[model samples]
Target: MKGKEKIKVGITIGDLNGIGGEIILKTFEDNRMLDFCTPVIFASVKTISYLKKHFKFNLNFNGINTIDKIVHGKINVFNAWNEKYNIEFGKENLKSGELSIKSLKEAVKYLKSGDIDALVTAPINKHNIQSEEFKFPGHTDYLAQELEGNSLMFMVTDTLKVGLLTDHVPVNDVTKHISEKLIKNKLDIINLSLKQDFKVRKPKIAVLGINPHTGDNGVIGKEDDEILRPALSKIREKGMLVFGPYAADSFFGSNNYKNFDAIIASYHDQGLIPFKTLSFGNGVNFTAGLSKVRTSPDHGTAYEIAGKGEADENSFKQAVFTAIKIFKNRKEYKNLTKNPLKPKQKKI
Candidate 1:
């Protein structure tokens, strides 16, 4: 679908010791998936071999010395690391963290170089992946810095789409990040992403309230009524179809989310909790407003079931499909906008 060629998706094996390898291998176990897109997993060949043996999986991957050697219809492993390291399943270690960052850096290099059409990242343990080299709270922040673009944590599924106004901040600190200007900027990012990435011509966005009961006209908290309402008004005045400071409690419960193209929540849990609850096994985490396309499984490293062969591959597979869908959508959007046609007028 990508210019008459299968899209090459570059994947980063999250924490080597986590369920990243298991999920990645399981996703590509069926050879038929290669027909949709070429997968290039950025991990050590030895790591994958070890996981295969440990899990008794029959997945096959083609190891390449360089990205140029990638086979057209094979699972390619771009061995980012060659050294022998201990991979303790279900345990967080410094070595696993280091390798995770190394794999991500390699994938990012190819992504920026246009070597891959999109990137699908495996889950990483945030605490273990922290190091002097990788010092962001999570993938969203790291990618924002590396790509030099503003990023929004947008969750996607066929049924619903959710974007967080404030991501990865503590509950106590979420309010500090909420401002009129910040809300408007985030809304603009979501709007642009809907049109450019998802191909929504005129996106209708729903903004959630921060306080309980939407601050009850300033009786509970002034931020929702004062900050969110004014911010949304300006965003709408700028010609974006945006609505709400709607109460978070009833928004999703009443199924009001189905009415809009995308929903914007004030904080992380306000949006993610509902989204994950509704679409945990099928949701895809899409990093919107990035120069390059990136998506990841909605769930994180399930270390408890890392080697048990119980981790679900549905989300990972959906991430791959979502990335491909978005990539194609963006391409078509570009083609449509490159030389837009004029509207016909009626005789006066």
Candidate 2:
């Protein structure tokens, strides 16, 4: 990390049976991307080479077994595993899940050790990737346990940003999950993330309601009136620019989301449905409020479009860019805050 050194971004090859390989290769195909950040993919050279040949990509990679051997100007493939994989497109298998977790764990190892500046994970099948070692719902929950701070699933683009209060929970259980403490904690995370990760000076955040039309004063549901409103009021007293519990149905359609720095949705679908609809191929799923930086494409593993070369790499590329930007922003923030400016003495 000297002058003009590129940020080393560690990427995990998620669910090799899916489109992870396709998107990863597609993103690095344009050699100009190397100038931005050095990519270290956590998969074997054999796996990447198989993908290259399967997709007929004219991409070259520098394969290495250790992080010290990473070449800054080329795509570095760190051999997380040595075994050959059977690439069955659009199929779910335990082997793919095992490999995906292996890649992820190896990447996290480097990320924690400061071997990599940031991480950009490829999409993984949530169901198949489950085991005794990994029992979380998805990346956010898993990272929250492994990382230092509370994690928030922040789906972001340049203009639009949405964070979920409760992600990967069933709709039936979503209401039970929302409470005053949860709301305040999530708001705090979102506020801090905006200032440090996204560089917003004064963040104005809006929260969507649990029920339609925000319960219409208790007609639709009581959770919005009984729980969300009070929590938001308490947060506002802390001098944060927080508002809402607005009607979720028409918020984005009415373009009211444009007024705030970020929006906090009550549940997963409430946030991601509108978010994916708006920024599917361009949005980056940033895991905020963690000591380490990690981001991914907004969409999941597109099993249906696995090996057809139809998967758009825009979101994946954006994920890489977002990780690099956040890493630099966090570093700058740390440097600025490490030493506070002393107050000037009054003239005698």
Candidate 3:
């Protein structure tokens, strides 16, 4: 596809009981969004109609049963399922989980087949979404299994970017999960992502330590000294601009993160807490290093303000914009690297 063409963006309606509907409706309500890319929402027209009525949204959409029927410059609602969903605001419903998974699976199918250029998923209830078919922790794990390439949960904004070394792992198992291979692989992914996805020619990355004060040189813990430092040393030898087992406590507070292009956290909360604290309502959860582009709002199902129309759509809007930007960046990167120029040969 050419760089100027509008890409197809597949969207999943997350938990019906949460703020997914509200945010989606509020975002597309402005017609200007359709000018960038065509949005294909993986939900029934009936479902969206219900949401529109509840929120009194004045948006117009095209309903279709097949992918070929999508209309450009309009919101397309593809009916993934025919059954009517019972949306009880601010409540957990197993049926809502089933529907959310259904929407995700269908959207992923189109995403894999290249019918869609990128994907922007809504939030789902982690606990309720668990079932026989979908046993993974969240979108990152599920997409990692379905799509090619290693996956990294990258939380991003215009200025700040953070990737997770270990995501969805328990606090006790975080130390056990850290290894040299994992660190190098994640660094490679982030470095590549920065160049191709974010247009960074030379990316600088910072790695946060597992323990406080980076194990204080083994006084606090041995993992930082034994595992993290050695891995970083080997990585640096390979000519990648990677640095630090910096103390997680002081990394953000000291504003040291601003010096680097991206930061890698040892675990989930250590990265997310600081990320959301800094960029909440504007940050996007991007699944980096995958063959296909996928992004989501940084926040999850906000059940408390589900149907009150109080949910913020900034993160969701940013997710869409980020997905479209990455899609274009990848295309440009591929075109630039498809055929390399040869160096001048020395006189024979």
Query: How far is 69's C-alpha from truth in model 1 (Å)?
Result: 1.0
lDDT of 1 by residue, 103-125 (tens): 99999999999988899999998
109-199 per-residue lDDT for model 2 (tens digits): 9999999999999999999989988887778888888878899999999999999999988999998899899999999999999999999
Model 3 agreement with the true structure over 11-121: per-residue lDDT tens digits: 999999999988988999988888888999998888999999999999999999999988888899999999987689999988999999999999999999999999999
Q: How much lDDT does candidate 1 score?
A: 0.90
Show where candidate 1 strays beyond 4 Å.
1-5, 343-348
Whole-model lDDT per candidate: 0.90, 0.92, 0.94
Largest lDDT belongs to which candidate? 3
Which pairs of residues collide in candidate 1? none
Model 3, residue pairs in steric clash = none
Q: Model 1 — which ten-residue stretch has the worst lDDT?
A: 1-10
Positional deviation of 123 in candidate 2, in angstroms? Answer: 0.5
Candidate 3 lDDT for residue 86: 69
